[model samples]
Target: MVIFLAETAQVLAQTPQSLKPAPDAEAGAQAYADNCARCHGPTGAGDGRDSKRMHPRPRKLSEGVFKFRTTASGTPPTDEDLYETISNGLPGSRMPDFQRLPEDVRWQLVYHVKSLSAAFQDKPEPLAFGKDPGKGANLAKGKELYTQLGCNACHGPQGRGNGPSAATLVDQWGDHIDAANLTQGWSYRSGSSPRDVLVRLMTGLDGTPMPSYAEAVKPEEVWDLAYYVHSIQAEPRWSSKVAAVREELGWDKAPRTDLRLSSTFYRNGEIVPSSVRAVSVQAMYNEKEILFRLTWHDRSESRETPSDAAAVVLLEDPNSRWRSGSLRGWTGKTEPAELLSYEDGEWTALLKRPLPSGKRAGLGVMVWDGGNAEQGRHRSNSNWMELILK
Candidate 1:
């Protein structure tokens, strides 16, 4: 399978590229507020109240953003470029990794910090983080490296904002957009130039889902990602947080239930009306057909309210990326069924149909929080997957 090759040969065989630069300001700002503000000023102007105690004083963020960064010469860093800095902070700087947060968030912060000033415009290309990323020499190699890195699952082919599972993501905003459109020359959140983009990627956005990828993806791979993302640039359909997860969590282990359809959906975890599950389900799938029996359980140590209003369920291969598709159902049975559970946190989807071929498959579950919103907030969780094969 593709995974085996990626794990053994690709990971090592591919030569590492220097940090590719591509940053996201929307994500970076969120990361800054979450971690950096403890010392550096909120706007990065060095006026943060906490900065008063620092011995050397926090660097004036607004005065000049570059001097401290690792850039590509007169140009600013790219998103991938900033990810390196966020994951591994400057040795002499007070910045540290709250890697405890998701990986993309740190990258977002890198984008955020880069947006602090427009200095990136006249900036020259940055020196390679360690070695220079070959100029236009690694596009094919990088594209191969991207899928090998599992980025294809989220970013989609050609970086065209059309990933297999991008349509169902629902965020705190209750709006859905594909992944960030890479082809656009303009930053969806910030940065008038590419360098600003890199910094935000290095720093993660605060109070959001984007995370720094310093630990998992190599620096050269990041550069490759930026290059490919640029290759497919165009009008963006997805912005900072609007995502569809129908692809990630839509898989079935056994076809014992029926499914209608699944889409990437989001919700306000905290504001999910008392008994409601932030993102809930109405039924299960049985062998590609829609079934009604479905249930959910909170089997973790995390604190959570009991769900009664709604629950969530996985629709296997709903997008047809896999061999089979799934059926989906909602409680209200209407276009806008109440998917979120209210008080009863657990529900089991009793399938009307039994296993046909009796095969088990892998699954994906909700893995994000909604964050601060009106009367609601996103919480964190580590939902796992089930198995089925025939």
Candidate 2:
């Protein structure tokens, strides 16, 4: 009888998952609010107590995005992804996983993190940068002015979508977008419009890495970024084969025709190559919840991470700008080299998230050169952009 009782207790402990709530989302919420609110913010915006002093910035869960997960293409992070990040802090960032929390408790905390942005409701309010007449001519000046005004301080050099400050940046999900990749000109959560550009530049995306330019930049300079954004090609590189492989496209609505998404690079553009080029982006859904497929791989014909990246899903938001959110970035990298083959290995990232608005979104990717900045630039390999289309 004693032995049977002991065995039963062990089974109960091992089968804890059989119970509902797993780790108790409600409990996690309170614990997170008390312990993480200071830096992560009550809403998980990554602007907690010490956020201002920290380089780069804290993770903003309100954005409902995470960079270090799955593959280059955004997808739901795996248990290992969460565990590893939680167990070990990033190399050059303020983000530190809750090592003290029990395994089940950590899972509960993940649920709470996901809930931080429930109030965002990224409604399509129409972003207007409001370009004046000279706005057109100021593009070159905007490019130059971007440096003088410190826009590069946050955005990055040349605004090709990289910023030195981003190395330590973290989001609500403990991920980082690093640079905005302004050249893309498309809002991850908002539609890509001149006004959309202005709103982001002027007001800054309140909760996330983007801050209100009103405080840091002049109105005229904001116009310059708008102008430079136009002058700068935010578009990513696309090959006819890859373009035709699954018909990369984007639309005002969720698409599931013969075309499918192989992978997406939020801001693949970079002036310099690092240890590994990392990419990340948040997609906004135009319609209802939907599912898509994605992929990623090295151009050197080498598969570093996984033959298969990860899976992501989408859902229609009753209230959202794009109505969907997607994020993807590099967790680590090895060596780097120049362009090797025109046709090489291609790893896929499968989409499996809720499609909030599902209309538009921010997509990003990376190609690092072991921390070398110049290594990322490639005429044939550098710069990239694509969308889900028919």
lDDT winner: 2
Residue-level lDDT of model 2, residues 51-113, one tens digit each, is 653433666767655444321222233334344455444433456546677766666666576
The prediction achieving the highest TM-score against the true structure is 2
Scored by CA lDDT, what does every candidate get? 0.39, 0.42
Per-prediction TM-score: 0.27, 0.34
Residue 282 lDDT in candidate 2: 26
**In order, how many clashes per candidate?**
139, 100
lDDT of 1 by residue, 169-244 (tens): 4433344423443433332333312333343344433222334444556666666655555455433222111112
- lDDT of predicted model 1: 0.39
TM-score of 1: 0.27
